[model samples]
Target: MGTTTMLVQCNCFDDVDVHANSVIGWQQTYDQLGAGHAHTTLKHLTAERFQIFRETFDKRIVQIGAAPAGRLCLAMPVCSSEPSVFQGKPLTGESVTVLHGGQEFFVQSPGGIDLLCVAVDIASLETFASREFSSADLCQLSRITRLDLEPAMIHRMRKHLERLIDNALVGEALSEAELEEQVLEFMLVLLDSALEWSVGRSANSTVSTYLVKQSQELALANQDEPPSVLDLCKHLNVSRSTLQRSFLSVTGLRPVEYLRALRLNIARRRLRSTETEQLTVARVASDLGFSHLGHFSGAYRTLFGETPSQTPRAR
Candidate 1:
């Protein structure tokens, strides 16, 4: 059996402010990129169908914001110059945030490289997928969720969102039932994703997660240090057998391999996003604790599918 749900979409830039008072629950979600003032394009997204409420062509929105239905939220930003929490984090995961909550995505609208964001709502989803999975499972699955960006999933979801935007742009119409189906699929994907995450978490033993997480922290903290397997046992007080099992179970890599991957992943990011940084094959290999240069190149090439010197770097 599956839970039933529906979605209401609005025309491009349709203003939902007038009904702000009527719609008991609305979140004022808008962004001017650190601007504290209000933008004209704020939208009040709700579960109710939009066609019923909006009769005019959408041009009213100078800004758009969506809050959960039956819940009210105000759109505002507090200025802070602090670097983003994700500043040093690798661009491996597909990031998602809520419409009206403690975290709201801020983007430069009408299309900008730095401001294009993909928005998804988990609550709006419902479907029976791979039995029931737990929150921990989802968190685990979410681990690879970012690491291995599911291109197929991304393509499907992107198209769906594109259609919604297109429909909004052209004011396209759909049957009442069809509209519901769209929302259903949207929610199903959401749940499916969560379920995938759950399965990932539960796939490994509790001990594995702890060791992997700890090892990851240590690796990041001492990227230059060669924290050998013996060091791991000394710090964590676990035998080689336990450490090997945990590493193999969660990340499927030995400590050396894991460190190599981590180093390359970091170096790759620095190459792509940071200012002029020389990560020559030998330099990178040595930094990652690979004593032999030849082996490092082979591993790096195999892992990233690119030669060390060929990495695209930007200042």
Candidate 2:
């Protein structure tokens, strides 16, 4: 039988219950604060060798658990600002988290998470690794910590995923085998690259990056009432200069600017949502912490090249 692909979109926390029947068989529980709505887009590609899923969730605290499906799963959080706890350790945006199918692990994301998850059947992946090196070395892969991947590499991975999604949606049998082979090759390449980065990483750099990620998570979790720079510094137990430096190094934007951008994006999404079509531009601005409507509109226009009112509501 040829591979099967499915795309699913959910608009609220209650809507995610249907995902239990997915190939990965995830059991999820979510806690949503305020009147904010949640949105999710899930694309699943399943073939003989492996299954890959592109999942995105907006504005929800979710806990996910799944039983062993005899696969080795690798998850890359693509635009995740908040730190997710996997197996009790906080995972930042810089690493790809791996999970052995037999070993159950928990994932908790505060919100705004985009993940690319690839699950290769254990037997198939073992056979592929045997050709690469000693089969005994495959055991070490299970113990591997989060693997570092550069931003450029992640961007390219996303582009590849988009192509795969497009191809899957087209439902052409002629290129199905070729597309599967490409996806397998890409997964192998990612594994190889991750192995290389796992060997030698500096302690100092890791700590700095973790701090920056924490700051980001804090800022994102409190979007409705963002903290000031001094508040952040105090909460993180770091000096203002240290916080600023960390934000610059990690996100290339100051803390305030990053928070502003995040709020603006949230407003934009709400404006475009069909469920929130009744929300006016002024309400969105005030709810997102913009006291001056004019300033909010100007900033929104500068960032998105259109005023908030210009954004069309989703039908």
Candidate 3:
């Protein structure tokens, strides 16, 4: 007799750091790019050898991380305010990012990005591929960083994965072994679709990913003394206009807006921390380069809808 014991979990998180840690068997860090309350939802179904999950976020988020070592992971956007960028390529319904075990990846979503992801053990995936594909096909699959599926194929895959989770949640009489077999078959079908269907080209990113990443790092590192747009342009060796356009394209925020948000978020974190004794709004604001306490409080309230003094109390 076949039996299945799949675990289903639905969780809501208010903090990006805590949300990143909620995923099983992955190392991920989520940075909130837009201000205001951050709310996220993750619904996952985990079986013996594979997992599928849907992630939804309310704020603009930049997710950086690696999947579990020894698993082949696939992720695609289901819905978003705008197409999310995956390693500098726009991720859409017809586009999927493929990562082998331990491959590092990054994705930036403007806001309200809904993504469905799947990860399966390498051995199980190899077994499935071996049966349905030639050796060359397997080799090519291993080399694929991204796969552009036919539109219908992407839709089918999404619906199939959703149905599997829905079935398991409804206490359908599907055995664990049976579910595993079905999931492996689904992966095989996806591979076959990739091979047989006419692949479409995904939209290219509007800005250079390196420029955005380096700019973000520089901004965060200088939170105590936020750099001006001129400084960023000079450091990047790009014209001010180019720098402005790049930040706007990638982050949906102008350079100044994004940098200010980063500093304010850091200050909010510090203010909310119970670990720091005698912490004050003035101290937090000053440490983050806020020279005027009144201005800092006003900006903080505008962004997060609460006064700086209330942050620690609420936390």
Q: What is the C-alpha lDDT of each candidate?
A: 0.44, 0.65, 0.76
- lDDT by residue (1-315, candidate 3, tens digit) is 011456887889999889888787788899999899998988888865888888899899999998788888889887888998998898988878888889989999877789999888789768546544568878999988887778888888888888877766666524565566556656766776677623432113644566778888987788777665656665776644455556777888877678788888888877776434567777788788776677688888999999877775433
Q: In terms of TM-score, which candidate is stronger, 2 or 3? A: 3
Runs in model 2 lying further than 4 Å from the true structure: 1-14, 20-24, 27-35, 172-174, 197-315
- Rank the models by lDDT, top first: 3, 2, 1
| Per-model TM values vs. the true structure | 0.33, 0.53, 0.59
In model 2, how large is the Cα lDDT of residue 48? 59
- How does candidate 1 score on lDDT? 0.44
Name the lDDT value of residue 162 in candidate 1: 46
Candidate number with greatest TM-score? 3
Per-residue error (Å), model 3, residue 163: 1.8
Model 1 per-residue lDDT at 241: 44
Of 1 and 2, the candidate ranking higher by lDDT: 2
Task: Return the lDDT, model 2, position 83.
Answer: 76
Which candidate number maximizes lDDT? 3
Worst 10 residues of 2 by lDDT: 6-15
